[model samples]
Target: MNFIQKEFRHILRDTRTLIIMFGIPIVQILLFGYVISTEVKNAGIAILDLSKDQATIKITEKLTASGYFKIIKNLNSFDEIEEAFKQGNVKEVVIFEINFDKNLENFNSANVQLIADATDANTANIIVFYTSSIIQNYVNEQNKTIKMPFEIKIDERMLYNEELKSSFMFVPGIMAIILMLISAMMTSISIAREKELGTMEVLLVSPLKPVQIILGKVTPYFILSLINAVSILAVGYFVFDVPVTGSLILLMAETMLFILLALSLGIFISTVAKTQQFAMMLSMFALMLPTMLLSGFVFPIENMPVWLQVICQVMPPKWFIIIIRNIMLKGTGLLYIWKETLILFIFTAFFILLSVKKFKIRLE
Candidate 1:
């Protein structure tokens, strides 16, 4: 009883540890419960309504009202479909033929083309399947109202990933997760090791400025992390057949930026943590959970609630994953992913500045 009381007092005294042990579990459970879902909801879609008839309008209304999809645009021509996809506005495009209603009325059948962006193969599959079911439901309802047998057949096409390869989805996500955890965790642990051994005090007494001290600590990890990133990319390309469809130089540059962000973030964590164990746990639970769960790596972000989606936007890995997927799978250039890139740059700058400030306060 005495030993248990002593341990309980120790645990209670460390407020940060207590919060990490108790609070994080609650937060993580709630986040995962709400965010981890297989069902598709509010997936963005586009309509190439060539028919411009009553049936097309009604079908469009039904699709939008069903809650499974939202129209990003009413495409003017078939040519706009690619542009719509490149803009990342729509996951699925529904193309109605020139005389869809006329064919249904006269020949008792019509064809509807369902083109989906298959970058995330699972989500694409679910979106198309849900869409087919809704259309088929509409066809069944029409059969009941009409004396003749009316049918609407779906012609499905998957863009970006023709085979709907799971690797296409997993590769980019894994890269984000790996880079974030490795770079941040290693840098934080390295700094916290110094802090624990009292060498941090020696460094603080030296003539080095806060920014220089930070740079000196993180430079080694930055180089090592970049090497780790290249090795992962090589494995992804050779073993998983993940192609770098966009400019390799641009990809490497973006990767370097992300590594810097991770290093700076790690430095920030080390400033807060008083010991190596604290830093390790902080890095793992804080960075790893959010990156894996909320970054849209393992789950679909559109399926999550609006509030949860807002939270995901703040996570650095979410934007990185988007940039990486756009570059690698879609073969898109900066024109398409400029917004995501800018967001990442802002995050990097914020962390670097904050870390420098925190290191100055702590050391001084």
Candidate 2:
């Protein structure tokens, strides 16, 4: 208890520790929740309306009013369509062929072409989808009045997140990042700081077992990291509408397991890092980047190259993200996530055993 209290005082007295413990999580959640999004809004487009008729005009109005598109240019020619894309002023171009209204009236069909910039395949797919949906809805409505011979309808069922809200994706990733930062980076730096100041040797020589000393150093951080994790989950749930469809107890239990894994990794890092700066750098470069990038936080793992996917298999955050997504989004129980849970348990055990072996060698 005395050792734990002393560790708490040392952490509280440090301004940087306080900021890292509290400030970063809140800022990151807010930033990613509101600012980062995959949904397209007000995507610029050009229209080439050769028909100059009411049908083309009505379709154009519907597309603009849908709010997913902005008609930046009423293009005069195909040349202008190419120029608009080249200038990066528009992502899509809608072309109506000559006698469009006549064709629709006489033959119940008109020629319309949609050309999209496929440079960003995801965004382009979204833009095309939104544009086509709006156009199709208008066509359906028109058919209801005109009594068309046949109609094709699409029934879209978006499971988990019907709206495709990016926040749902980001909240889980942010929680993993915050927990990793607080548990692993802070723990590593704290232990390295003690070693740098020569206090670690004194503590090692005192009336404490090797495991006891390591536990005393990490216990305070474990508590603080749990608090931080709960805070992030609270903000994500209330502010961002992120849901925990699974049992809250299970979510928290898995979170604790992940925190333990991170703490164990921190201990291993502390054993190797002789200076606080080196520990920080090592944690940031090794743990932070993998947590953010390779863990399917920002990039989908399926999209990565085969070799990168193999590398991501060893990343703890990757499995943690899969576990949380299954629990939160899919609402699956332990049976569903047992494999990932076992993997995390193995990682935690491996790190702890390695750290213990290293600590014993250092003491000898």
Q: In lDDT terms, which candidate is top? A: 2
**Which pairs in model 2 have colliding backbones?**
none
What local lDDT does model 1 show for residue 268? 91
Residue runs of model 2 more than 4 Å from their true location after superposition: 37-168, 361-364
Clashes per candidate (backbone, < 3 Å): 0, 0
TM-score of each: 0.58, 0.72
* Candidate 2 C-alpha lDDT tens digits along 48-100: 88988987899899998988889999998877776788888687888888887
Candidate 2: residue 161 lDDT (0-100): 25
Q: What is candidate 1's lDDT per residue for 199-316, written digit by digit as tens?
A: 7788678776777667666765566567666766775677545688998888888989998999889989988888889998999899988999998887677768999999998999
Residue pairs in collision within model 1? none
lDDT (0 to 1) per candidate: 0.79, 0.82
